[model samples]
Target: MTNDMRRDFANREELATYLKEQFPEAAERDDHISPIIGGRQAAVAALQKVDPVKYAKSRNFLTGAVTRLSPYIRYGVLGLREARDFAFSKIRNQDEAAKFVNELGWRDYWQRLYMKLGDGIWKDQEEYKTGYSASEYATELPQDIREGTTGLVCIDSFSRDLREIGYLHNHMRMWLAAYIVHWRRIRWQEGTKWFLEHLLDGDPASNNMSWQWVASTFSHKPYFFNRENLERYTEGVYCKKCPLYGKCDFEGSYEKLEAKLFPKGEFVQKDNSQSWQKGKRKR
Candidate 1:
């Protein structure tokens, strides 16, 4: 699939030539691609009105922060460098531009990590066992979670949004990860796989790394969410109407889990205990 020239060509000249011949002027005039491109132009026009400050404050708030550029990015319709440069050009303020730039950096970082680690990053880490199991839960569990049936108000709402629109707020992504890892006791890898399968903008590195970060496998501290945090963040949009609001038992604790994975405030050791124990046994 990666080698499919129709999707991703190394040179624009080749792509342009192909587009020109395959879609002559008369055909191009009547084709749907023109309208789709026109729509993107319209969206860009709207975004240009907001500029930097609006994007910085609202980007993480489950609203209009997203660029909706994923389909173009994924299909090679918009090249990565093109998006980066355009963002930088428009949002000239250092801090405002930095927010968008950092997100792009995350994309690059994930790609590099995937290339460097390959399948190893997906392997089970013994360190993840605390407060959660790495096993795939019953299919019903995922279905319930995805379908917003888990009863956790915030998670259910986000899950429903994802199912209906294939999108979730940035904060909601973290919330969902915490719920799946801490509340559901499911493996981050499983959650990552699920998102990759369903998300319209899913990229392996971002999905895996984000899951690991929430699972507390990649960072020194495990991310946890409490009802108060949810209420505050979501502006009381959740909890009141949740199916599991009163009945669920998970408390969203991370102190012990963080200590186990990230002792003495250090990043989690990359599970080298096997080699250490084997060497000691040999002695």
Candidate 2:
């Protein structure tokens, strides 16, 4: 609670123990610490492994070759330009680094919007396109969701990973946000708060804007996913073992899900096809 708080610790474990002792309430909620190390050395080491070519190809999948450098970037241990420059160093040309660079550009865009919008970023940029009034959405996140006991295997797993590891695959983040806002009809701000509380890379601008994007308050349309799309990207790892495999909420085509989740909204069809699908053309 004081500026004179201890800064010296023998190791990460000691530091964690000290933090838990100082902040018992936080520990009670979840004592878990992320395995991702911090500091410039770790950031540089992570940056050294940047494979823009492979990242462009597999970044959407659950087990993709992601750089996992967001925490470093978020905390300023590594700079965005530094990461981009390093990625460029490994690539043959602009096309090879386009996807990776594009992602970095998105982060920059979000931050710029955050600076421009100020506190306005917390408010909806536009009325939600989901055809529901703001009053229709629940303001509080459900207890089951916060506890990671939703019983839907994929969702529960995502919730658990978020609470325990303080990170999620970008796809999982989108799916979870969509589920909370569109599927469960909870307000996106509630989900946004939860993500900020836990994500190691939780940049308020990026996190808030992303939830708004899913909620249709900051995008042309709301984003949702079907089981087939989820399974294809995640290699069916969660669906294959889920007790609700065939009967789960996500078990349907994009058209079917669209009708169900946003019944009152003008339906805009989103591509359900996986980006990594071989032999299938991008729509």
Candidate 3:
């Protein structure tokens, strides 16, 4: 039999040095980033504290009571079935618990699709469903957005949150995706790659297709929101300090936004009455 092989670090400094050398991208994060406790015990502790009743009501808000169990689930330290059991045990009310369970279901849904598609998950599964061709979008994220210097205060803060902490609110993820895909006119693939690099919970399956959903590639319509929508959710924290203010990139309702951005007037309307069937069938 062959001898077992092993390597050991002399100290934390040596470990840090080795990690930096081998994985230059895994740099240190800000102190304010949410503290994570790994292992089964910590996952159990975190799960026990989840309030499904409150989560269903305020989960969309920035300060919402979300069960921060994503990293554990992503790493295999926790399993979906166990998490679901804990949720159900806490709240027998199916309606309130259903919302939380459904959110977890999305993770399973993404993984199943990922296995079915294999490598095809990385490539575009359909044409840009927004009535625009693939040729119209940028292949790479813009330098400004990558550098977190877009000058839109809220977006920049979100950018810093992503890169620094490797975490983001789900709504913020959609908001940024909508901005890049619809407003900046970048390809969803570009956004996906960028997000994958930083998101601690980033799974290629859910991440990429969700980006497509914002692009209307996987959904019936392109997802968009005006500044007012941002203000309502974030409680005007970023907008108040923002120079873009009311005149920031997203300025109008869907109709006006469509006229301003996709002036070709070929995009499907909100009601899904008009068919954008030119692309691959929506999954």
Candidate 4:
């Protein structure tokens, strides 16, 4: 509200009050994730600990050694160029660094796309790029998902982590988004709202586009992941604890998925062509 409020913090908890004043709803719904200590000095402290080499190898897994520099980067506490320089300064191996640097480029891509599209980001960039029509998807996320009572242990746990901590592993995000958009037929916007509310690093540009990416509004096909894929990457942690072990929602192959999820048409085959054409026409 004031210059002193924005710039001054006697204690780190002041960051929470400042954030509440700025985004009252988000701060209230996602109160568990602590307010990060503000300023460039704190940002640099987080940056100094980045290990780009290890990040490259294990970035896809839930337990990966990825740098959690997103909150800093999203809020402008850490600049991309400075992070790149720091990575290169610490690690001599260029190939290993490439994996991490490429992700930064992704951040740039989202920001540029947001600048270009503006509010259009919230609108469908394209039609249902998957097998179904835009009419088929639900406009809002289901109450169970918002309440974290989805019955599917893995998804429910992911929901709790996102709401409570305001951070999720990149892989967890993709998996959860894929399940919601493809398997449940919920519109990406529904998922986008929940993600934006909870994610500490929730950039409107990156977050919305990513939900679009999962929902196939901005990509070739809807991303799908089955139980096997989940267990493989997730180290069987959630599955082992899940109540619905074998007969859960995600048990099947591509063909089975089509029949079970979308019985009318095969989205993976060719229906997406019309959607692409429609988007092109609008452009």
What are the clashing pairs of model 1? 151-244
- Pairs of colliding residues, candidate 4: 131-267
Q: How do the residues 113-143 of candidate 4 rate in per-residue lDDT, one tens digit apiece?
A: 8899999999987777666888888898988
Query: Candidate 3, which segments miss by more than 4 Å at Cα?
Result: 1-18, 25-35, 265-283
Candidate ranking (TM-score, best to worst): 2, 3, 4, 1
> 99-172 in candidate 3: lDDT tens per residue?
77887887888888889989887776666656678889989899788767999998889888888778888778
Per-candidate Cα lDDT values, in order, are 0.58, 0.84, 0.75, 0.76
Off by over 4 Å in 1: 1-50, 124-126, 129-142, 243-283
Highest TM-score among the candidates is held by which one?
2
Task: Output the number of the lDDT-best candidate.
Answer: 2
Give lDDT tens digits, candidate 2, residues 216-240: 7877777788888899899999988
User: The CA-based lDDT of model 1 is what?
Assistant: 0.58
Candidate 2 global lDDT: 0.84
Cα deviation of 4, candidate 3, in Å = 9.8
